[model samples]
Target: MWVQRVIELTGWEPLGVSVDWAVVEGELGVPLPADYKELYEAFGGGVFSDSVYFLGRDEGVSFDFLAQWRVGLSVDQDGKFGDVSAVDPYAIYAPGGKGLVEWTPPNGPTSTSG
Candidate 1:
């Protein structure tokens, strides 16, 4: 499975965290992909290889998916992107709206290996 591959590649152990997908989907106003749900359930949230960061259901934590989405929506709504007039405006994704949504931090990923 892809999750197993991820574990092999990143050497990350599965935490087997349980999540209420119905609640999460209700809040997000969208159904998450099955693979993504699987991944989150397995690993929770953490940095992988000090690079990829998985957003999980841990509320109030930095890697909390819903919290990050709210922050992204706020930024989009408040016109926080400075001096980017050329970029086309887009709405944050909602129940029936199609638009941009943040799946990770803007800083991209980093590597811990030196």
Candidate 2:
């Protein structure tokens, strides 16, 4: 409903392909909101309103959430922004730890745990 309204208002086009939610959730390790899923299903992944860019799922590509998360971890590991611990307060070292965790409701506040 809301997604349709927004799409109608913004004139955004659908991706014309169904997404594999199970794989996506497995990769992210979190359940995405229905609205977000709907939006992604409607628009795929691309820039919206000239400011927002939704991350799309692409096998073996760097556009998916896992890839983007890895990029962040890599940047932190390289200490490009100084000490990793100092830079990433909420980061959960997944190599031998509990792994990173992020929880968010539909357009609600987010909670993170390592």
Candidate 3:
């Protein structure tokens, strides 16, 4: 229902993201690449508030926007496998506060899109 509402309002659809196993494995027990870490830091890593997540309270700022948010993800479950972790992708939807009146989908590309 909420996902339908979002599509109605923004025309963008919720896409099941694809993850690279090798890369995820690299990050599972070890640190991610330096450039990637820097990017996450730019997104406010230590903070998990809505403001630190682009799809949450970040409104719709581009990756170029310093206020934009991103997560330094690692060892995530993939569609290729049945289960890898406790995090259920279906349980996680893009959260936004301030109601529908103040929501804007990213105009350039999907959050994981380039």
Query: Which candidate has the top score in lDDT?
Result: 1
Give the candidate order by descending TM-score.
2, 1, 3
lDDT (10s digit) by residue, model 2, range 1-114: 899998899887766547788877775566777788887788776665986668757564544766776677666774453434324455655556664554555555443445
TM-score, every prediction: 0.58, 0.59, 0.19
- The segments of candidate 3 whose C-alpha lies over 4 angstroms from its true place after superposition are 18-50, 54-114
Each model's lDDT comes to 0.72, 0.67, 0.36
Consecutive 10-residue window with the lowest summed lDDT within model 1: 105-114
TM-score of candidate 1 versus the correct structure, residues matched by position: 0.58
Ranking by lDDT: 1, 2, 3
- How high is the lDDT of residue 23 in model 1? 82
Question: Which residue runs does candidate 1 get wrong by more than 4 Å?
Answer: 8-11, 49-51, 78-114
Model 2 TM-score (2 dp)? 0.59
| Residue 41 CA displacement from its true place in model 1, Å | 1.4
* Between candidates 2 and 3, the lDDT winner: 2
lDDT of 2 at 77: 75
